[model samples]
Target: MANQYDRNPFAEEEEVNPFANNNTGSVPAASNSRLSPLPPEPVGFDYGRTVDIPLDSDRSASQNLKKKEKELQAKEADLRRREQYVAFATYLGLVLCLFWNIIAITTAWIKGEGVTIWLLALIYFIAGVPGGYVLWYRPLYRAFRTDSALSFGWFFMFYMLHIAFCVFAAVAPPVVFKGKSLAGILPAVDVLSGNTLVGIFYFIGFGLFCLESVVSIWVIQQVYMYFRGSGKQNELRREAARGALRAAV
Candidate 1:
């Protein structure tokens, strides 16, 4: 209502933008982000770099592990083959010993002088052969196949007992340990003057027992040395301790 150019000293002054373009509209903060492009990344920045760094050491270590695994497999295979050969020899010996013992016992029965020995031999054959296989030989085989320390321990224990039995048989003592021997050296000598055929059978039986004892001793030595070298004793102790703990639990 006042004059158009007149100034009101009590009124607030409006700000003037020296460089503002009249054609452009005011932008809001939220809309500014959408309107503007992101700043360009530095020339050699690691923004686009992959997360995983390729390392030669990691690749080489993996290769080495695979190589060791292969070598171990090859060694185990060779050991298995050697064990097979030994097992074959052992089987042959067992069969021969049993066969010879049978022949000796049969000869004793026919002669009638060593029928008591024949009875003992019959029991021994029935129990010993199968017991040897189940108690010792199979355990030995399993130990080799599985690399089981426990199985090896069982084999050693039973095989030692078998060796002792072999020694007793070779001695051929009469009336000792339920007549363990078929026709020991004593009977062979006693009957030699009277019956040549029976004496020969008895002597041969004694000799075979001696041979078996020697072979058993040798085989045990070989197996034991290998077992020790393989460092299975520590593993055996660990397994035993674990078993005890489990039992307690």
Candidate 2:
């Protein structure tokens, strides 16, 4: 029974330990042996190492250029082969003309008439073979080879005349100009009643002439269409302008 005023109510009470003085079995402290060594400083990355990468620009460019060159060569070869058909057609027409004239000469000789016409035909044959190549075929060939619009224009002019010649030679109208027409369809039809053999020869000649005419017509149409469709007309104008400028200069 202590006096109430002598007790301080805010003071903490002291805790008592029952085993403070007991030393027969003691607890051990926590050990660091089982804890893992902070995982070995995470091995620093080798940022200083450098790697080289190769980019062969020149090799790539050379390969690309070679590929383009091959393509161009193939295209040019195809163009050459394609354009040569027209030349071949021209040669064929000339050969047919040669044979047709020969037949005409033989027929005239057999008939013992039309000597003047056969002489004229002989002269044409002598000139036309080489002349055909030089005049029309050569120009067209040069136009194809060099892409020359002037050459194309020359070919057109000469080839048109050639086509007209073929038509007249094929039809063989009466010689209003000079002599009886070349041995052609009309002449063959006229001679058929008299000499069957001569008429047959004339018809053969007429057939050759007609073949030549047809070939000439087809070639001219094809070439003219190609000229128009392939924009060569524009090129022709440009070339003309260039020539005029050069002449003026």
Candidate 3:
């Protein structure tokens, strides 16, 4: 029993087994095989929305300018629409004045009753006919086409010119034919003296002339409100437009 306990088990190894190929030092192929190329990381991701790329400063500014231009064009279109209506009324008034003057002059000449009144009426016609074209038609045409506003100076001058002509037209018949009130065939005297037929004519015709002046003042105000109520940049633009127009004129 003592000798059995002291003996080495199987005398260390039962003869070398040459057929065994088990080598603990060799590693398996799994570690070296290309690690299933890791799932590619995503590029740019949004929550189902397209991303906005950064824009160059100049390009952004140019787009903004185009947007402003479209808006300005729209505003100008609205202004021109109203302005055209006023111009139409002004033109109508001028035509009426021309016809009224011709009729009044002819009536006075036939009767030979109001020489001074006829001559004054002729002068009034001259002022209103051509002056209307120059002051109202051309300026308004340019304003509408150019998308520009008449400055206060231009409008004031025009308004005053009309007032001067209309006041004389209304007041001159009495001044010319003072102390003779019976059968005054001149349209102005007839109107002031309450002649039904002539008074109605003057009311419609000369009333329109006065109306045109009033509306012109209003139109100028509207235009100023539109063009002048903006920033410094737009103010400079309007000023430049005024200069260019003056040169053209």
Q: Report the C-alpha lDDT of model 1 over 168-201, residue by residue, as the tens digit.
A: 7777666653342465677678768878987898
TM-score of 2: 0.64
TM, every model: 0.64, 0.64, 0.49
lDDT of 3 by residue, 1-249 (tens): 367568676676668778865674694545565566788988866778976766787799999999999999798787768866775665676567556755645454445545665565666576667777777566656655654444333543575666555444443355445512212224444554644455455455555545655765666566556545544337556787989999999
**TM-score for predicted model 1 compared with the true structure:** 0.64
Between candidates 1 and 3, the lDDT winner = 1
CA-lDDT, candidates in order: 0.77, 0.76, 0.58
Stretches > 4 Å off in candidate 2: 1-76, 176-181, 241-249
Ten consecutive residues with minimal summed lDDT in candidate 2? 175-184
The superposed Cα distance between candidate 2 and the true structure at residue 89, in angstroms, equals: 3.1
Rank by TM-score (best first)? 1, 2, 3
With candidate 1 superimposed using the best TM-score fit, by how many Å does residue 144's alpha carbon deviate from the native?
A: 1.0
Q: How far is candidate 3 from the true structure (C-alpha RMSD, Å)?
A: 12.8
Candidate with the larger TM-score of 2 and 3? 2
Return the top candidate by lDDT: 1
At residue 187, candidate 3 shows an lDDT of 47
